[model samples]
Target: MGDIRRRWTVTARARSDRGPNGLSLLPWLLMGMGALSHLIQGDAPNPVIGGLGLFTFNTLYIAIVVRAFSPCHRETPLTWGLLTALAALTFALAIGYGREWLLLFPLLGLAVGAVVRRRKRLGRITVPLVLAVGVVTFWRDGWNSFGVVYGTFISVMVTAAILALDETVRQLRATREELARTAVEKERLRFSRDLHDLLGHTLSVVVVKSEAARRLAPHDIDAALAQVADIESVGRQALTEIREAVTGYREGSLATELDRARDALSSGGIEPVVRQSGPPLEPRTEALLSWVVRESATNTLRHSGATRCEIKVGGTPERVRLTVTDNGRGGDAATAGSGLKGLRERVAAAGGTLDSGPAPRGGFRVTAELPVETQASQEWETTG
Candidate 1:
């Protein structure tokens, strides 16, 4: 936007390289005719007539310069160039028959746009430059000449208008771009979290199912086939969930995560117990806790050698908690693993805290607590 306003500012003073084109040629032609008369009749010049001719010079030269200057901000350069040509024809009319007063309209527009852009310095510079010349011609023509009065009024009004409009445009454009950038950043964050969860949980399940199939293959062929079938079915479901996550269409259920965890543990010969209490969850909190359950279950199936697992989820109006504990031949490896680290990140992002380590009583325990969601639901019900 600064660039846009600056362009209009620079154009006011800039000169063009080429001869005026299209309609602009008319002004130059008429200016040339008048200048020809001025040259021939130099010996006996009337002050009024001479001032009028000089005023025409102002219009002719400005038109030539404005037309030549092109900004790539809009339509084809050809369109701007054609507009310049049109201006030149207006300049010719001013020189021939005092029509230079018409030129004030565009100048007013440009000036108004510039002032709006907060280019006070540019306005100061242009105002004096145009006024000084217009004033001098007005005085020369004795202040009563219609051409002098009209041209001066028009130039001042048009220049102010252009300056104001230009500034307004710059500010609007800047705000629009900022909004677009913020939207993109938010979407990127969402996709990153979704991809991390999808791949992490799915891969863990795949590892566990593969191990189950391998162990059962030697003695129980039917069991081995069943394990393989579960692996395939689970993988397809994971892929579908990933597609939904990317599209932002589905809100997943906590029950589904618990169901998957139960299947993986039962198949691996571990006894699984689930105890859930408290009022029903708001959809968002349920989805988040559900994710925590899935991750914990997957880690247990893939890494823990525990035979007994206990999962408990309970909450009050102000907070919610999820705990997964396994009584197995415990080791420090799972605590130091990548799966737990990723889970910690997801938990933090959801405005919660996760603590995972060996339980003093027997095996390993993972616990997470979220305070904000229940508070939000309480607020909603009260407000309702």
Candidate 2:
């Protein structure tokens, strides 16, 4: 869970710091030319003054593309919004007081959109604000020109594209997060099952030894001490096996996993029905299937309260099938939480299919089929 939260935070910080790309450059160039003509052409102070102010405004807006992207705080949303508002206000004054100011109104919306990235209501209002104010001011008066309409259409298209891009980014981020969650859950499941397998065998051994010692203590002190000694040895051995199991799983080798599973289920009172056919498998595939056996048997003992676990490992020229089924408390995989989720990721990552559910005969069943692109068939083999 902590990992999930951290991932999201990292994504947000990165996204918030991103700048508008080169896609916005064309409009800036067009606007820059208009500003240059108005500033440089006129002799009168009025036209010159108006042009210089719009030019300054246009320059500030352009500078944001670089400044906001910088590591500095200039690119912050607040900075962009405030500065853009100032630019729009200056632009409005340059165009004169009436509907011409409305033509520039849509630009002011950058302030609202930047601060509220996902607000649909704000966008709904903003588009209409742009169209309404723009058409009335741009196409309304005797001063209206075709240039204004063309510019308006272009701005609208640009805005729509920007919105679409933003939405796409958000969706991708969401998908990545969901996958991460699935991975963590599967890991937890694997750990829990392994832990159960390890401890169950040791505990049962301890109980049996203790009972034997109780029966013999009145007659022989040495025999009782031997039983106590066995308990300590079993505990230390379980701990060692646990550490080894954790390290071994990472390697994901099938042969090693089979050996490990044989050792684990035997201790936990699980009778494994192992079957193997044909030649040796890819080292990686063997490891993954082995873990599947170890984890399934462990879960069978701890959760299902079952006495026996049947593990079948077989493969044809095309694919390998590993099935572990127990007659125990079988239920939905949804109740599995993080553990099953992690297992699913492991299987999926290896291009395998996992079919886990309650068996028809009053038990839980787990069947995983992993493709063997090579030419090998592991023949029937069993261990109890």
Please name the candidate that would achieve the greatest lDDT relative to the true structure: 1
TM-score of each: 0.53, 0.46
lDDT of 2: 0.60
Model 1, which residues run further than 4 Å from truth? Answer: 1-116, 119-193, 219-222, 269-271, 303-310, 325-384
Clashes of 2: 24
Model 1, TM vs. native: 0.53
Question: Over the stretch 308-380, how does candidate 1's per-residue lDDT look in tens digits?
Answer: 8888887677678889999875567546446567667767877888998887887888998876444433211
Measured by TM-score, the strongest candidate is 1
The per-model lDDT (C-alpha) reads: 0.61, 0.60
